[model samples]
Target: MKTLTLAATAILLTAGFASAQTVRIGTEGAYPPYNMINDAGEVDGYERELGDELCKRAELDCTWVKNDWDSIIPNLVSGNYDAIMAGMAINEERQKVIQFTQNYVPPQASAYAAMSADADVEGGVVAAQTGTIQASHVAETGATLVEFATPDETLAAVRNGEADAVFADKEYLVPHVEESNGELVWIGEDIALDEGIGVGLRQSDTELKDKFDAAIASMKEDGSLNEMIGKWFGEGAPLFE
Candidate 1:
């Protein structure tokens, strides 16, 4: 919500980037591969690396700020941060509130994990993080949707038998399944949801959005964006053409 003064606007127009002030980039520090608090207590992961590169390319003085996923948008709208790079999907519902840079991550499937491969994915109780596309989808599907405040809680619901399955981003669920030692398995076919993940910006901050959009485009064209995606999501993840 920071507005540039006329002199600052002139400088920004000449610079061709949102450089009038430090752009605060908000992210959920709990989502791994997308973003997480590392051993050093600093934000780390794919979005962190991508955000740094975008800032470098855009010539924007930027800083990373951690926010809970459920309130991330509201805080941004309230000017708690200037942009969001928290693996948020670009969809019609979100478009009504905020602007988005072109997707840095491509459309990917969501998967259901449960204790048994035969677990009922349709009619059984399923857990999903609150305010997520997966949560809304599970509510719409035949499954009895159980909501949790955090991604870990959704998985815990499956682990503790509170829910039959936990539905989430396939990449987000892979590490848990692999490390589950046979306790968790993919229960059903993957479900595609949302358009893709992008950097969310305030609707009024079109200049900031344009700066990030151009930086994302440059990375996409140079293949560095795909490289970072693979580094985090694994080589099997889909990449842009």
Candidate 2:
């Protein structure tokens, strides 16, 4: 819904840093284990905790901004925020418009959820959040894709039989399926979408990006990053090693 250019992005980043301003990090507060609005109506989740640590390590003054997922990248490009840490996987398509720091979270699986175990996610009507890798994957496959503005809407479509299944990140869908008490179940094996999750920044903010990248690299080297990933995603969660 929003668009951005490299020149505009660079100018914004340069001006903000000149005065030692707070670097605003953008996230979709609706995706859990990554980002969500807590009971206090503030951003919380793995990204929140990880972002705070990353900022602390980089010694940068930073803040968080919640934005709609579809507009997250456009807003970042348009200078609504200085970075993105909303469980975004690093991929070639996204790399074309914006730059990314090294990945923080390892590549995770995507899966399908439905009321029936045999639901045809491969060919039947499937729902996915708009502007996500799942939506793009569904569109490219034989399944008829139904796009929703949010993840909850996609699950609701499946629960109500409006869709055969909902395709999304396995991490996000895991709790929902477990809570369904047999009402919903995984329909297929895991689907791998991108390389890993990373911080999204404007191409011009090379200096800022380097700071976060170095922090992320340090965490990886010390195993603190994997510990954080396991803590949030469960002990069985994937690790760099």
By lDDT, the best candidate is 1
lDDT of 2 by residue, 1-241 (tens): 1222434433433442334347899999999988999999999999999989877766678899999999999999999999998888888999999999888888889999899988998789999999888899999999999999999999999988889999999989988988888999888689899988999999999988867776677677667888888888886788987
Tell me model 2's lDDT, rounded to 2 decimals. Answer: 0.86
Off by over 4 Å in 1: 1-15, 18-20
Model 2, runs deviating above 4 Å: 1-21
- Give the CA lDDT, 0 to 100, for residue 98 in model 2: 98
- Find the number of clashing residue pairs for candidate 2: 0
Task: Give TM per candidate.
Answer: 0.92, 0.90
